[model samples]
Target: MHPTTTLLPLPAEAPPSLTQILDEVTTVLCHILPSSLSVKSFSTRWQVLRSKLATLKSSISEVSDSLHWSESPLLQTLLPNILSTLHRVQTLCDQCSDPTFNPGKLLMQSDLDMATGWLSNQIHDLDLLLRSGVLRQTNAIVLSQPVPGSGKEDLGFFIKDLFTRLQIGGIEFKKKAMESLLQLLSDDEKSANLVAKEGNVGYLVQLLDLNSHPSLREQAVSAVSILASASDQSRKFVFEEGGLGPLLRTIESGSTGLKEKAAMAVEAITTDPDNAWAISAYGGVPILIELCRSGSTTAQSRAVGAITNVSKVEDIRTALVEEGAIPVLVQLLNSGTASTQEKAANCISILASSGEFFRALITQQDKGLQRLLQLLHESSSSDTLEHVLRAIYSLSASESISRVLSSSTTFIIRISEIIKQGSIISQHISASLLSNLSISDGNKRAVSGCMGSLVKLMESAKPDGIQEVAANALVSMLAVRSSRKELVRDEKSVMRLIQMLDPKNELVSKKFPVAVVSAVMAGGSQGCRKRLVAAGAYGVLQRLTEMEVAGAKKALQRLSGNRLKSILSRTWRA
Candidate 1:
């Protein structure tokens, strides 16, 4: 970008005179360059060679411009040699831009990286020969590093002047100049950011907006993304350069690939609250949501993440959800690629979890249950299934959910496996869903065999694990008409269920009580209540009458609400 950004110094002494160095540069350009190399190839290698050509051009221009040839024998001889050298360098940059030659494979040459290093050393030797105070031609190669200044100046200060100097030279060298910057962007974010610190970010920003080469534009955007990720300091450095406006604009205008990178850029930019708030200030949500609606899978997924980041504020989150992101996300569950689905799923879950705000979708008011259920069945990955289930649970209201599960008694099998095998997060999902997971009439038939397993489990395990699971499975089993007799007749089965109701014993040991209470409150129409109450779960509820916990509170309310309602109804029947 600008040469003023770096503090690179001039070498006071080194081997090789100016002309000797020019001769070596000439040999490398004319002889070392591949016969098939194009101007673009040579141009991309501009960083390693531009300084020498700039110096040679400067010396020749001086001899022709003002230095009386008679004034210095060096200028007279230097003029002709410089002429030939500049001609070769020009021809090399031209060849690089040609299609007849390959730029890609050529840069990948076996010795090129080493050649670049060697070329750098020769240019260094030439810099040492030029006098510091003499106004040399603007012909020296631009070094993107800090070095000793011409007069102990800050390298960072000279950068803007260097860029302004290039501006005067016109963009004739733009093809090569931009290539150098792109390389700089990828090479080290710190160096790229330094160029930005000197205000070179404006150059990249301006370039992204121009109707330019697709690949080149992408490179420009990618460079900005790199700088933003470099350091916390650089992140703001880019933002202040007026970058987000153009970037968000580009996300709306570019192809899927462009949108993808732009979304990724948004991700890096939104890594913190202030940055995210900046994006929101820049109209981040609408752009991201539009991208989600129109872009490819990767684009949409990343856009979802970007939207989520910016939505960390409640207003922003509500804005997105109100803007109809919920339905769009539900559609995305089946859209895009696998990675896209995973991301969209997560984004939707985050929004669903923020508040009881998504009651419409969760309660089946928006008819989300069936759609979510299908995803849970169709998804192959354990995580994807977990997100779908949680989102469904988060979005739905409980009683409406009950109607949906009424037909699927066996629904808990898939979920039980999730607890046993999935991530800790998903295992928690299993715990959360266990209370609402209903036993289908078919699952009722299956609980008989597992009943024996459940009893054996309690006898040998940790108190919390055994009781929690026993409570959950007991609640589930009590729902089965097919498994009810054996379960109740194990006569001692009633006592085991009763014994688990100890409030003091339940907390450290059990997480399954919600289902246990739900089962007891609902499982017995006649004999079941006495069976469960005989088991002492009713007394346990009595003990918790004065307790508090979000879950325990809900459990107590449900336990009380259903028992009183059941007693009133039964009294009328009598």
Candidate 2:
């Protein structure tokens, strides 16, 4: 015998490599292997081997950098999907490979946490797209619902198999598969296009009609955002699909979580002027007004954003103002919380910029001015104050309205005190409010008594402070033609202004430098211009000319031309 061990025959099923371990079996298997198997058996085994080889090759191809088909559209489209599929597949494989990733436990626990995090983010982005979703075909609300008997579905069986493999394979394998799926959906354009082609958008809309789950609502909203935002066509679909109605209802539905998103839908709807009209046609105005009136603070904020979007149109703005948004906002500025105060103040400020708003709102100056002053004095929040000052600036900017409030010495003194005590931002705003006060002759006299302090305030306050006060004061002072003007007789007054115009020794503390420079240029006559020029005004003017591109350049150009030569001629020769 070739070996001491005896065997009847080597089994056909034994692996070839195992034969070497058996001294006698190796020779016996070699001799018997060819005759033991029939042709049919050999063919069947070969087919199985071929199939296994193909699967191995497919898996290997997924990991290869060469498979990164950046050139072909088909590859580009399929690559992300293929990769995501493989990622999800591998993650599942790895989970089953380890016992720690048990389905019986919480899904968020252990390695499942990673997958849930990924899925949650995906769900979040998808939710953003839903309410905003504009399908290439048509727009519809989307809701997702889980179907029954999914347990017995073929996909479920494959999934079960994959999980089993994951338990044996490890978490790393499962993670790899999940990564591939995420990569595909991450690119918005590609994903949206694919979604359009597959009628996923339509299906989602159908889901929206039937489903009420918070998770489904969130996902649906995401898709809508993507579509409405993506194109005009998509937005049109969203409006046609009755999206706004549901969103408005959601705003009032008392779901704090959904309120913000509902408002976002309104914002997207009003992004285009035509859409604004469509929204108005759809009765968005009263809904938004009510949202502003009675919705939660968050809801109100969102409602305001929605209003702002539509307010770009003149009709929408007029509707809002007519609905008493202006007075309500003015009222809220005083009575609302800090956040509400700020929001109301900002909206009024925006409204005040419109000629219509000013005509409608500021016409009642004394009544409004009193409320604004109260806000200025009472609120401690810096944000509220800044915006309150801006709103005042916008409203009282008109000479007529300002004349009404200018009669109040109390208002004048309070404003003056604020200029002195407030921070730089406050100083800038205080200075602006002063511009409005100067519009009235009576108020000018009251402020002129503090002209000494005004001069000092000008010296220390910031450039923003200087801009409005100096510019407006110069115009108003020159416009007065008053020999009896309260400020004109103060000899040190002109002198103080001249010192501020000096450029060489820049007192960076000047609150409104740009405005101050402008005021000097505007009000200073040939002689006064000469004085400011001599006090090193040119250097600062030139520096500002170079530094700023807007109104600052216009001021510099005016000073450099006729004003400079004329002033020198008047001051030097005389």
Candidate 3:
């Protein structure tokens, strides 16, 4: 029925032997040995080769213990050579990736030919070793004892070995040990905690010193980054153990890779509020600012992160601004990658929080406002949107910035939309910006067009700060004749303002609504006055006139003129 119902057996598919995998990896590596290539193309090829080699290394490590090396003396003899070849390949990869090295000029055609010949010989040796029944070996010599389980004792012993190696091993051995420990700490939080508790931060700090090998120092910084990232205790240990000096030095002068790792570690340490001051004290702020300007993209990003964390403290923020970080940060905002832009924006937001002086400097010197507005229009990231909005809000406190922002129709409309649709933080910041911008007559007129949105914000069940700011914005809008009529004509807005005059409300809440009512009444618009009286404004004003609150007397006077003051005087006389 089915062509004699005979199912021919499928060809037996053989799994790749270890030698085959090694040969495949070596072939990939050999492809990168071509000279006379474009720098960009060479970089691409090099990255591919590096990835393949890393995969091969990981594969070997995963199976090394199970390999029966003694069963085939030939394979056993070649094992160390194979590992040495792999390490040399990795070293070459590292050299290529080094930021300082110009790969295009470093390797001539003759040099590449030599490298190719050497790699060919290594590949042939590996083939010979594999053919001598290397993959068939089963009897293994247990040269190293295995730690049976991942118990506390096992972890302790493992950490002790790492510490011993870090303390006394030669440069290469120290680098490997540190890299292994860093990987272990990153992979296992328990190990990081144990390392931190055991006071190993001092050794890590020592490895970062200037006298150490650059590669070893880089590994030490990475280890510190992992440890600091794991927990607050580790962060404190790193900070207290005098790690900041070496870390900052590395950021200032180490290789590009080292700078990135050191910046990251600094960021981790600065997350604790207490250590932030220490960084500033160590002259780290200016160095971080410099990195943001000249370091690689990754280092710039990490530097921005560290600056953001450190800028959380008021004193440090002032110090950062004085170090001319504002303009540099603005530059990064305009040209850096998306992550860098967000971090720079966030750092500027914190710096802007320090005072109006920094705000003016940021908005005036660097075209910061223009850049922020552009990012706001282009970015879909909520974090970027939030930070940029906050920075704008703070910078708008400057009178000049307020006028400038109000002059831009697109800026004003976008702010209105953000208030309507953004996250809670964004909405609040937008409302505050509106309030700040509305201080100028031009801003008052511009913001007045969005009266309905501001009215809705004032009517919302938001926090006291947001509602207060929204009310203040409406007050500014009502002070403008064109916006006054629209606000008065909106019966819902009139009712919301009347509701805010409650005596039981917080003093801050009552202030803005009273001022808004007073502005509308003082405008002498018959329609607005009618609406206010119709919305039970007289009773609210009458009650406020009885309280000893600030602005109550002025509000009553504006609402009812001299009659309210006379009535109040009569009530006191009674």
TM-scores, one per candidate: 0.52, 0.44, 0.60
Taking the tens digit of each residue's C-alpha lDDT, what string does model 3 give over 1-574? 5466778999999965656544654554454334213234355444454454444444444334436533433343344455456555545655554668655654633344444454455445444333333333342221122243477755655565556445534455566667667667766776777787753679789978889776777678888877777788887888889988889998988888888888888988888888888887798999999999899999999899999998888777778878888889899887998999999999888888678777778877757788989999988788999999988877877777777886777787787778767777787788777666645566566556567666667655666577777777667667778788878888877777787787765533566677777877777666776678788888887788787666878777676664556688999999
Residue-wise lDDT of candidate 1 within 1-574, one digit each (tens)?
8577777898778655555554554454454344324334534456555554454445433433432223332333333444345455555455555668555764444334544454444334223223321123242334344332232134343444344322322243444445555565565445645666664676667767858656657777877777766777777776777777778988988776777777777776787777777766777777888888988777777787777677566667777776777777767777666666666676666767777656554343354565567667677777777677667657544555656564554456655555455555555555455545554656556435545445434443443344455456556665765465566556665565445446655433333553544554553444555555566656666665555432545555554565788789999999
Ranking by TM-score: 3, 1, 2
Order candidates by lDDT, high to low.
3, 1, 2
Predicted structure 2, TM vs. truth: 0.44
Q: Which stretches of candidate 3 lie over 4 Å from their true place?
A: 1-158, 165-180, 210-217, 277-286, 309-324, 349-369, 381-403, 423-425, 438-446, 452-467, 488-495, 502-508, 523-574
- Model 2, 69-108: lDDT tens digits are 2222222222343335335534444454455655754442
lDDT of every model, 2 decimals:
0.57, 0.52, 0.71
The number of clashing residue pairs in model 1 is 46
lDDT score, residue 511, model 2?
31
Best lDDT among the predictions, by candidate number: 3
